[model samples]
Target: MERIKIHFAYDGTDFAGYQVQLEKRTVQLVIEQALAKIHRQDIKVFTSGRTDSGVHAIDQVIHFNTPLTLDCSAWRNALQTLLPIDIQIKHVEKVDESFHARKSAKEKIYRYQIINQREYDLFKRMYEWHVIKPINIDQVKIAAKRIEGTHDFTAFSASKSNVKGDKTRTIHAIDVLEEFGRIVIEVRGDGFLTHMVRIIVGTLVEIGIGRRDQSCIDRAFATLDRQVVGLTAPSHGLYLWKVVY
Candidate 1:
């Protein structure tokens, strides 16, 4: 058997999530089915990470072991023909047998977009979180700066999560930019807990709207309590931007 790495992107509007579910459409399931058809064997995929329901990905990576020997481009194009319109296989390459996508990843970046205007963009409704009220980008940055180091992120993660690791993770950066009536929050971390990025965005949104002070972020980090943070922003606005190895 040979190991191959694949890079892909998908719009997660219809799928349940990246992981396979009992009876729901998923990015992993679709790819696994396509691989099974092409290889004529049971092919399993190991992903860089998981995204929640309605969350999209731009450069998600995965690896699989296959018995067939085929050109890398042929493998990519053939899988694209089998996948749905929302999912696209971007590239394929042969890799060392020990290359595990998730384990080899050094960090992951996720971006959340918010439409900060009165009227929503119809085509972008399913891709962003819309906020009618005005938001102060500077205030969001102030809150963002408070959480930019190795700290326990329990306050910014969903109460019910299956993430297994030390809660203390390093956040390399949290950047907030406003452009074209949209607010973008980019977070890069070594790893993330389930819904952690969305919750961090929600906490910053509260600070931007004057509902919470920037100091509250410090308190939340010090306490490591989930109740200290705000709501988890909707999944639609979140995207797995990239995975760094």
Candidate 2:
């Protein structure tokens, strides 16, 4: 069997999420179906990570094994032609059998986008979270620094999650950037817990709007309690920005 790695991006608004579920449209379902058409057999894919419903991806990595052989360019062109318009095949390459997409990933970067004006961008509504009130970008930046470095991220994870084992993860950086009219929070970390980036974004937004203070970060970390954290930002505004191996 030859191991093949694929890189793709998707507009997640139309699908349920990244994972396949019964009676629901999913990214994995569509891609696997397309691959099956080419190979005339079912193909199983291993992804770097799963994104929630309505979450987009700038670059998502996956790998699978197949007996049928094809060159990288042919593989890319073939898959793109079979997949939907919303799902784009970026690159396809043959990789070593030892390489696993999820396990080989050394770091991941996720970005949460927010429009900080009273009126939202009509066209970009599906891609960005709209904040009716103005927020202090300075406060948000200060609060974001607290989340950087290694720590226990128990308070930032989703309240209802299936995560097991250690809750400790090292966050390399949390950068808040003002691009055009959008406030984008890009978080690069060794790994993330379920809804970790969303929860952290919500907490930073609270601090920006004066609903919470910077000390909240310390409190949440000390308490190790989800109740101490802020809201979980909506899925639509989040994007799986990049993955590093």
Candidate 3:
């Protein structure tokens, strides 16, 4: 058997999420179905991480074992032909059998996009969060800086998530930038809890809109309460920008 690694991207607008689910279309399900056809048997793929519904990905990674030996370039070409148009295979290569996708990941970068303009662009409705109110970029930057470094991110995670064990996570860096009419918030971290990036973006948006002060982030960390944080920014605005191993 040979282990293969693939780098891919997907538009999550039409899928339930990355994982397979009953009675729902998902990125994983489609990819597996296509692989099953090629391998002439059932095949399972492991991903670096899962993205919530409507959360797109630009550089997602996955690995799977197969009995059939084939060139990496041929595997990429065949998989691209079989998979749906919304999912694109970016690169593929053979790897050691011990290289698991999720466990081998060193870091991940996520980006939240916002269009802070009066009128919403119909074309960008699916990809960006449209906020009509003018945002204070300076305040957003200050809040982003405060969220960097290691801390317990339970306050930023979804209350409904049943994640056990430590909630502590280290955020290596955060960049808040404005280009054209879009405000982009990029965060690089070792790992993340459910909705953590979205929640952080929401809190920053509150700071930008004057709804909350910069100190609110500190308070959220001190209290470890989800309610103390700002709104959970919608999933559509969040993207899995890259996964580093």
Candidate 4:
């Protein structure tokens, strides 16, 4: 058997989350079904990470083992033909058998988009969070900077996450950028807990709108209480931008 790595992108709006669920359409289930058809057996796939429902991906990574001896290009073409239109395989290559997608990942970058205008763009309604109030960019920047570095991110994580272990994670950077009337928040981290990025963005937005103090991030780190953080930004606005291995 050979281990294959596949890089793909998908529009997560129509399907459930990346993982498989009974009686639900999901990216993993669809891809697995496609692989089974090609391999004539059950083929399990592993992703770099699980993206929440309505959270799109620009370059998501997955790896699977197959006994078939097809080249990378052939594998890509076959998967593309079998997969749905919304899910596109960008590239494929053979990898060492030891490589595991989720465990081998070094860092991940997530981007959250916000529209800070009163008149929402009809084209961007599904992809961006529209906030009617004017947000203070400078304040958001300051808050973003404060969130950089390693911290116990329990406050920013979902309270009911099934992950059992230390919640401490390292934030390599949090960049706030504005382009064409859209506010973009990009967070690069070693690892993230469930809903961590959305919670951070929501807190920063609150700080930008003067609802939360600039020091709220610091307080959240110190307190480690979910209630101390700001709202959980809607999942639709979040995107899994990249995964560094």
After superposition, candidate 1 runs with Cα above 4 Å error: none
- Tens digit of lDDT per residue, candidate 4, span 31-106? 9999999998999899998998889998999999999999999999999999999999998989998899999999
Which residue pairs clash in candidate 1?
Answer: none
Model 4 misplacement above 4 A: none
Q: For candidate 2, what is the lDDT?
A: 0.93
At residue 96, candidate 2 shows an lDDT of 99
lDDT of 3 by residue, 101-218 (tens): 9999999999999999899889989899999889999999989999999999999999987789999999999999887769999999999999999999999999999999888899
What TM-score against the true fold does each predicted structure earn? 0.97, 0.98, 0.98, 0.98
For candidate 2, the C-alpha RMSD (Å) to the true structure equals 0.8
RMSD of each: 1.0, 0.8, 0.8, 0.8
- CA-lDDT, candidates in order: 0.90, 0.93, 0.93, 0.93
Candidate 2's residue-wise lDDT over 1-245, tens digit each? 89999999999999999999998999999999998999999989999989999999999999999998889999999999999999998888899988999999999999999998888889999999998878999999999999999989999998777799899999999999999878999999999999999999999999999999899899998998998878999999999999999
| Candidate 3 colliding pairs | none
The per-prediction tally of clashing pairs is 0, 0, 0, 0
